[model samples]
Target chain A: MTTPTSRPDPRPAVTMSVGRDKHSHYSYRDFFRFNREQGTIIDWNNTQNLLLSEDFIVGLQTGLEREVGDASAAVMYTIGIDWGKRDAAHFSQWYEREYGVGVKQSNLLFLLETWWWPFTAQGWGKWEVETESKQKGFLFINLFDSMVARTLGDVGKPVCHLYAGLFAGFFTTMTSKELSCIEIQCYAMGETYCKFLLGGQERIDAANFWISEGASAREIARRLHQE
Target chain B: MNSMFAELLQNAEGRYLHPDELESLRAYVEGIPKRVRIYQVLHSKESVLLDRVMEKFQPTLPHLTRRHGILAWERCRRDLGMVWRYCCMAMLLNDEDYLRDKLLYWLETILKSFKMRDECRPAYKLMLDSLASIFTAEESEIIRPYLLLAKTMLVG
Candidate 1:
C-alpha cells in the first residue's frame, strides 16, 4: 500500500503494542511456582527445586573439607561442572520454548543475560559478564554475593571453585568445546567480588600456571589480552 | 494489564503482597495510558524519529560522520533505537532502576571501550531533545525522567 520508508529491520519487531502481556516473555512471579499446600517447588521448566539453609550450605563445605581435606575444592568444582552441564540441556530447552529462538542464533550477551537471571532469581548472585574480549577467545564474569563465598567469607583464597567449575561446565556443554574456567579473583580472597576467566583448555592451563605464580586477576587479564 | 493484576496476587514466596508493595502497583496503573501511547508512537515512528535525530546530528557532529563513514548513521540509529527502547521498557515496567541496571551500564561500557564516549555523549542529549516535537508535556513528563536517568548514567 505504501513505499517501505525504512531500511530492512535489524531485529525482531517490538510486538508489545499488539496485546502482549507485560510479562508474557517472563517474570519473576511466573519463573518459579511454590505450592505450599503440596510442599513442592517447581520452576518454569518444571524442574524441582530445593530450599537450602545458609547453615547447611556452609556446613556442606566444612563437611567436605573435613572429609577430603584440601581436595574439597576439587570435589566442589567437579560437582559444579556436572551441575552446569546438566543445566545447559535444561537451559537450551526452556530457552527455545520461551523465546522461540535457538541458543546459537541469538546474540550471546543477550542470551547470557537471560540465562543468568534464573540463577540470580534463585539467589546464587548477581553477575556482570564481559564479552568485549570474547573475540580474543575468552571472556570474564564478575559475580557479586556469591552464595558460597558470601557465606564462607574472607578465607584469603579463591573459594568459588564451584562457581568456576559451573561456568566451565556450562560453557563447555553449550558451545560443545573443551572450555574451562579459572577463579582469577574472589570475594573470599578480600576482593569485593569474584572474577572468573572462561576460555579453552590452553588458556586455562596458562591461568593455572599464573595463579601458582601469584598473579592477580588484572595481571591475568593483561597477559591474556596480550596473547 | 493482566500481569499487573496477577502481580497483585502472586509473589515469589507463594504469598500475597503486603498493602505497601501495592503502592508500586498503583503507580504502574496510573502511568499505563501515557506509557502505552509513548510505546506505540516510538514503535511506529522509529525510523522517522531516527531520521530527525540524524537531521540534527549530522550537521552538528559532522566530524563523526566523516571519521566513521556512512555506516556510522546505521550504527547511530541502532544505538539511539536501543536507548529509546530501554526507556520505553523502563517506563512500562514502572521500575525506575530498570533502564540503568539493564541497558545503560552495558551501553556505557561498550561506548567507552570503543572510544565512542566523547562523541556519543552529546547524541544522548540530542536523542532526548528530538522527542520534544511529538510528545506533549504530559507525555514528556512520563518519559523525560527516564531519558535524563539514562543521560545521567551515560553522558556524565
Candidate 2:
C-alpha cells in the first residue's frame, strides 16, 4: 500500500472565535438552551442513564475512528498496486501512529478525494444501487425535489434536479465511494451541472454518454463548454 | 438485557406494588367500578414502576384488538402524565392513523393547557419534544410547523 509521507492533524488545531453572520438566524446559546430543555423529554432510567452517558460518548469516538480507518483503507485500496491489501496492516498501523489524536469518523471526509478514484473504474459503479433505488422507489419524490430546488439553483431539468437532490440525500447516508456510482450515472445522463460540480471537469469519460444512455457524453461536454 | 433491567429495578429501590395493586389494575381494565383514586395514587407514587411495567408489557400489547387498546391508551394518556408510555402505546397499536390522531390530540391539549397557564412553559416544551420524537415523519410534517412556531414565540 502507498503511504503518505506525513499525516495532517485531523482535529482543528487553531482556535477561532465564533462570530455571528449578518444573516445569523439563531444564536448558539439559545440552541444549547433549547437542547438542554429538550433533554427532559426522555425518562432516563437513572442507573442505566449514568452508565450509558459515558459509554455513548466513548462509543461515538471509537465509531468515528473505525470509520476513518475504513475510509483510509478505501483510499489505499484505490491507489496501490494490489488494491492496498498486502500492506493493509502496516498502513493501518501507520495511520493510527500518525493521526491518533482525536481521530474519528468525521475524519473520513479528509480521505474522500483519495478514496473516490477507484470508484470511477468501469465495473465499480454498481454499488450505488441502494441510493438509486431509494430515490426511485419512494413515493415522496417531490419533498426531496423541492429541497434541491431550494439548495441548488433551480435550473429546471427534471432529471438533473432529481440527480442533484439524490446526490445530497446520498451524501447524508453513504460514504464517498458509494456515492461515486450516482455521480457516474449522472454523467451517463448528460447532466452538465453534475459533471461540473462533482467530476471537476477532470477524469470524466467523454465517450460513455451515448454508449447506452440518451445523450452522448461528448455532446454534453460540448454543450457545457459552449454555455 | 434482563440483567440490566434487574439492576435498574434494584437501584431505583422503589416500592413494590402488592398483589392487591395488580388486582386493582386488572379490575380497572375489566370495567369494574372506576378506580381513579387508586390509579392516581399509583401514578403519583409509582410512576417509575408503571413505566417499567409498560415497557415490559408493550410487546404483548399489539395482539389486543384496536378498540380495546385505544380505550386503554386514552385512559393512560388522560390520567397518567407519562409521555413515553403514551408513545409506546401508540407504537404497539400499529395503526398509523389512530396513532397520529391521538398523539396530535394529546399535543394540542398540552399546548392549550400551557397557553392557559403560562407557568407550564417548561412542561409544554418537554411534551412537544416528546411528541416530535414519537411521531412518524409524515405525522411530524403536519404537527412540526405549528410546534416550531409556538416554540419560537415562547423563546422570544
TM-score of chain A of each: 0.86, 0.20
lDDT of 1 by residue, B111-136 (tens): 54455767777777777887778666
TM-scores, one per candidate = 0.65, 0.21
The digit string of per-residue lDDT tens for model 2 on A58-133 reads 4443464477853532332233323323223333443344345322332332332212222221112211111222
Tens digit of lDDT per residue, candidate 2, span B56-153? Answer: 44454454346334576444334334333333333333223333333333333333322322433443355455543454455444444444444444
Worst 10 residues of 1 chain B by lDDT: B1-10
lDDT per residue as tens, model 1, A122-205: 778878888889888899999999998999889998889888989989999998988889899999999999999999889989
Off by over 4 Å in 1: A1-27, A132-137, B1-127, B131-139, B150-156
| DockQ for each numbered candidate | 0.15, 0.03
Q: Which candidate ranks first by TM-score, i.e. highest?
A: 1
**In order, how many clashes per candidate?**
0, 2
